[model samples]
Target: MVLSLMNKDKFLHVVKVSMESSPYFQLVSSSDAYRAVPPGASAPVRIRFTPSKNRDYCHELVCLTARERIVVPIRAIGARAVLNFPAQLDFSKCPVKVSTQQTLLVRNVGARAARYQLRTQSPFSVVPATGALGAGDTVQVTVAFHPLASGAHCGSLAVCCSSGEERIHTKLQGEAVDVIVGLSTNSMEFDRTFTTMSSHRTLFIENKSNITAHFQWKAFAAEKEENEEKRRQCLLRPPKEVPQENFPEEKETEKVKGFCGDHSALLSSMDQEKMAKVKLMNQGAIDAPFTCLPSATNLGLLFKFAPEEGIIAAGGSQAVQISFRATVLGSFEEELQFSVAGSPRPAILTIKGSVTAPSLHFDLAELDFGDISFGFPYTQRCRLTSSSAVPLTFQLRMSDDGTQPAVDSVDQIRRDSDPAWSKGIHLHVEPREFTINPSGGTILPQGHQDIEVTLCSNTVMEFYRRLLVDLEGIGKGVAALIITARYQPLPGLPQALPCPGCAGCSCQGEVLLNALMLCQLDTRTAVLGQQPVVKSTFAPSPARSWALF
Candidate 1:
């Protein structure tokens, strides 16, 4: 606050101003103080008051001059500004997917200016929600209601002050009513799809009215009436063509009055006896005249729509994707409802498709390498064919046994190698017991893949491995090959099976067995921990001939 001081006398004079020192009162124009107050000219002193609390303040202002000392009193008033906001607001019965707004009057009742902010949740919003109002000033706030569904929505509006840490909440209530919407297509027809595969179609939802439209695809309830009027609710219409009204007033059949001219007492007696007989017939068990045919099952599991619930803006369109997937093989025909909030009834969508098994197979079920020589490598080839309409990705792995799932045991002794000397190799001795070239690959429709499988053994063991064929994308796994191979120690490497890097032995033509790695019967046999010796000049005694006699 600035106060003007004047030197009323017509003489050159100096004036100094000071105020009582306190936390709430401070001098703003210190340079102007203790200055020469020219004759007939005025001087101003500025003072600032910062209120620490809501209370009144008083201070003394002192002025010094050459003639006399003048004293003045100052007071700081703390009048808090108040904004009045309503306790509750209601946007009654608004159209669904449409926005309805109302204006509100907010007044500042105090002698000071106030700034406030307003906030709320979805379906309920405030426009120009934040503002500053002068003392006794009133501002208009528009509260809009945009609901997505047909129901009552409740929320709270908060008004917070910029100066003080105080907030006021106003309870908000709104209701949404229904409206008519249009669609590009009402029924969907999916093509024939493979089992465990999907076929997709798209339909457009048109919100042609002024309001936005929210929709959901709700499945029909079980045990519904089979009336023709009810069935007509779910239908397809051309663009801008409105659907038939669902609740049409049925024509009531007028009752016919029975006033026959010829009436006999004896005939009336016979009719009463017939009525008694009909009551006796109802007392006994009655069989149904017709058979209960099987109704179509709910297709929600196999038929689906992407973005099952969403909102379309006013005068806008949304493309909804429809997908059909089945796990079993059969033809399917089912119907469900496409319900828009505030719509009289849901639009019926018919989905029809068939699912069959995709044909994929191997030429040979089992790959058997019989009597494989030890310390040697053997290789074989097989073919995989695909007659499916769509391409398939496949991966090969050795099963734990002949049962379903298994682990890959390579770089040890079992299963096929992760690909011979394939990836991330370390210091390894043997090149696995089994290995397959191009272990994993893709096959196009009506295509075939030729696989090369190699077996290189360094130990004496029999393998009864089960090769598992895993189909990617569509996971229909089948235990493929029953791989049977054996490797055992021999007296010498056969001429047919040649070993190139041997120190003492050479298969130039054939190698003769001069020594045998044999054990004495009395000492030890082919036990786990026993070792045999090479008896080069061995001649057995004839004790076995007497035992045979």
Candidate 2:
């Protein structure tokens, strides 16, 4: 008997079926338990009935859900013969041009013997066309599957009883797979200088099969003993998780209950279920359905895919851009593995490259003082190295002119110089403000020099200056080392005071002079009064005094 179950709720509903206190009726085959049934959709539940005695049978089929439980009634006569067979046949995965076989057991569980005939469609044939089975007897029917193409193939098998009973039908399914993929190139090589800029290469991937194909590309260094040990150590470490403090207070309270409190325990269990479901959904979103390999991380190479990941239609192509930047100066080799869906082995693409050090190079492109206070001094240092085999002399000067020349221009100047700029050498920078010590220097092959630049400001404004360095023998227009600095205002300064002098003044005249004489009664008094003493002191000095008023 077939039971059609329909969902009426808006949200997803999970259904399960069971037989309640009915020994004669049993669940044979049905939709999976805990299966999600969408709203307004139906799922089939198949049940079988068998009787031990000759009489009418009655039973109840129980359907359980999260919202409610449904009871379905079962009624069948005990005296009838029933043919039992599997609901479907699955050949699973079969390689192209390969034949696979499966068996189905047919049984007669009834009061009398029965005659049955088996019929199947193309791509599938049964071993026995007709068979007879006594009561409580069984027969095995073998089905052969031979696929010619790559894809899912489907057919059906039907069984008929001579007693004019319901015809039993079972679905047949099998999948044939032969994946083919092509790449435009098998290897790539790059010669890059050690710089912040990255070198890029494009790989063309084409799908050759009729079915859509999925591909994943990864870059990894060649396997080494030390690298393997590091990988092992990385895997040994436990995964990091959100701290307990990040959890909600309610969740913490629930955790504290320890599943002892009835309400809190129920809620905690429900929350755990929801969290598990959410985690599963998130994982499904991140990982492709067919991918079985663990995701790789920290392979050292960076890559950008036009379409990070998606289905490539048959005869379609995709572009994958892989970029590499070497942090150190040396020759390095790496591998890029392309994993195609259903393929056991990955396609390995070789990548080999070398990074050469510049002949004359600076440790950094620019030095930044960030922010400096007024009247305060700030100093920074840069290392310049001559990596060539010959002695090189470099001259440093300020780009006093407002116009700053390009580094390429400095390089051109060096190239156009009398000695061809000493081979693989260039000048850079134009300084407008600030002071650089040891403006010029000479260094032996593979020698290093440190240049110190200091900046001091007295005004309350942004200060910018560039220091240019050039080769000693090269012309002035050649490259110059460019150093930059900026100054900020400092705090605390005396305010301006108002002037006491008149704004306009023109006074240049002297007043008439008057002389005064004083007569002293005593010599000590005369001395104390700051008067010039004369010998043989006389007391009549009143007539000798003259006054001008």
Candidate 3:
């Protein structure tokens, strides 16, 4: 009976449907396109039970109903690809050779009832002598190929699965690369031997490539003439264009130059090999100076050059624009150089401009320390101006906060000069002095306690002082601590706090008191005392009885 059931088509339907939809079923028959299902397929599938051995009638019936299974023979095929190189293939060379390794995946691609083998055609080899594919199963094979020549290469990949194998040809592709060379030249000439505050100049970029081309700007460099020692430091020049503003017939300037050069170092330290070079392509061209000295006297263009955007292509050339406003009046020239592609050699350009003080304004017009804590650090700032035609210096002083005196210790105060804009003016601040603590706390036996607060300023100077007090341990029976400050003058001023009067002024007042501020010593006692007492007056009553006796 089981043998008869094994021959039926019930198992075939089960295998077909299960293999088609089950994620568990990857390997499939060649008729089953893994990419898509055939036009006439059922939504849900049925399973079949096939028993090869013989069984009793009742047993056979039970097996058919209870032991039935939907077998979807999963057969799937996949390939692995990799690139390998031969000993002779060098990336630096004109042509490159590469090898590819391929691995094939073969799985059971058939109905539960069917089983088969995988085979391939020409130019390919399968690993095992004879491969057996099981229902709902998979296997892999390896293959290798080499491309001998240059240029783009193309080919096909093929595979076979159960239920009649089919070929899946994926186009194989690769390429060999090469390099092309080109040339360019940059020469500098001065229109006037003497450079002034206002100087007009044009920077030229020429294409020396054999073919017409579009090129990306790489970078530019400039050098000062050997004799002009004072003029070596130059400013970075703005580009060729500027936005227009209100006011008719305004002579608009296209660029603004920035100062450039190691003004801090001596001339003997600067040699050709160690000279500064601007890289335009990889090395950034000077867009603007990050920092400058306040006393810079000469001005000039400080910038790098680069091939214009797009490709440097074969031949065409592009020029970068350079212009400037003379900030300092003087005679100066600086040598500049920029590099193109891979060549170590650089293009040389020169910038000439003058430097004078621009209209000066204070960056830190004024400063408000806001409010500060006692014993904590605080700072205020104010910018000074040198536009008065002469370098000036001003002193900084801390004003009184009100009730409290400003800390006097000015001996530790320090001043700093801006390397670029301080212009002989120094910024200084005195060390912070003064602190606040709980003055006193008191509690009465019957009601709430009241506290009085006092503050001490480290200095006798008449300045504002700010302080913070934290209180604790004050119970509901105690009122908050109240604070008020008063000023008192000193007989004499100390040498360190020489800036002011010997008197200190009042500042912020009124703050609450707390229980933590109260120091408690508990007074507890258990008393034991001796005393004499008479429970009954037996002596007088007994006296009468004794008299009778």
* Residue clash pairs of candidate 1: 178-342
User: Poorest 10 consecutive residues of model 2 by lDDT?
Assistant: 258-267
Candidates 1 and 2 compared by TM-score, better number = 1
How would you encode candidate 3's per-residue C-alpha lDDT over 181-276 as one tens digit per residue?
234435556565565555565664554434343445533322233323323322233223333343133222111122222222111110101122
Off by over 4 Å in 2: 1-78, 179-549
Candidate 3 — number of clashing residue pairs? 93
Residue 518, candidate 3: C-alpha displacement in angstroms: 34
State which candidate has the highest TM-score. 1
Q: Please state the error at residue 432 of candidate 2 in Å.
A: 99
lDDT of 1 by residue, 102-133 (tens): 89888998767778898999989998878888
lDDT value for candidate 2?
A: 0.51
TM-score of 1: 0.32
RMSD, every candidate, angstroms: 34.9, 41.0, 34.3
Q: Write the per-residue lDDT of candidate 2 for residues 83-146, one digit (tens) a residue.
A: 8877888999876656688877777887776688889886778888888888898888899987
Q: Give the Å error, residue 442, model 2.
A: 99
Q: What does candidate 2 score in Cα RMSD to the true structure?
A: 41.0
User: How high a TM-score does candidate 3 get?
Assistant: 0.15
TM-scores, one per candidate: 0.32, 0.20, 0.15
